[model samples]
Target: MSNIGICEYVIGVIHDKDIWYYVGRYDANGMKLKPNEQYSSFLVDAKRYNDEDILREELESLPKTLTYKILELQRCPKCTKEFTEHPALSREDNETEICPECGVKEAIQAYINS
Candidate 1:
């Protein structure tokens, strides 16, 4: 690759607004990076690799579905326990997964754990 390509690299999600985006060096195929990587609010389209135009073209593409699960504390109707970050999802305006069974489990576990 070129010097710019080796110095700068980006990672992004398939769909949904990225909560976390990462960017950093590619390690030069045989080097190591220090201090890990950096996070950015704006993400680069992963489809763009080697050719920025391809990524730019892919920017119009959207994933069929997208969802996010957050663990939050809640009292389970069954277990009556609250867990840390137990998810209590409600679909977002953009089709994000708002609630999930894992959230219920985590909430109950958190409640029990506490």
Candidate 2:
């Protein structure tokens, strides 16, 4: 299987043709090499093999921007209540949790009467 998400690549072999190259494969999980999971590739030569050393470097970087995505969305201006990712509010008749700051007071009043 191919590597998904972030993973490690293994240097399975080396090809010394006209161009010097280091071949390797992506390891699924962080573990000692196993026979079946191994694959092959042409990375950099001996001089730039340190490129593989940076494998774990990405983990040191800052996290994703998703937190800003969720936080940046506008909440209700009147009530300051953040809009959740849940389904939209149902008809007033079917629900009782009204946003007192923004709900139509007359509509809620009529529903309360009937």
Candidate 3:
């Protein structure tokens, strides 16, 4: 059998006159749609599409009151914590953010080992 790549789907809705979007991933089997309770219009019945471009087009076709933003987060490998803030200057990659707590812990451990 040929290997198939996982597809990402975006969910969006209009609430209190504002637009919000959430990104989710899925495979050939099925998708997991867990909408945030805080969002006013939780998109429980939103459809999942494989192509991001097509999803963007569909979202844009919605009413003018609706808007969408792609959600992306990079997590730290050590702490397994997701962060929206940019990584420190010492970090080589912009996508990954080593949380401050993890950074301090690693620094102290390195110093002790040295």
lDDT of all predictions: 0.36, 0.32, 0.49
Task: Summarize candidate 3's per-residue lDDT along 1-114 as a digit string, tens digits.
Answer: 121233446455545565544434332356543444323333333345667788777666545654555433335565665433344422334454476677777667768988
Alpha-carbon deviation at 3 in model 1, angstroms? 7.1
Cα lDDT of model 2 by residue, 1-114, tens digit = 222222233222222432222222333354544433232232221112224445334323313421111111124333445322222332445553334344565456668998
Evaluated at residue 76, the lDDT of candidate 3 is 52
RMSD of 1: 15.4
- Which parts of model 2 are misplaced by more than 4 Å? 1-72, 86-108
Ranking by TM-score: 3, 1, 2
Worst 10 residues of 3 by lDDT: 1-10
Between 1 and 3, whose lDDT is larger? 3
Tens digits of per-residue lDDT for model 1, 1-114: 123212222334323444533333334354444523433344331112444444444434423243322212233333333222224553223232223564555567668978
Q: All candidates' TM-scores? A: 0.20, 0.18, 0.35
C-alpha lDDT (0 to 100) for residue 74 of candidate 3: 39
Give candidate 3 misplaced runs (Cα > 4 Å): 1-50, 83-85, 88-96, 99-114
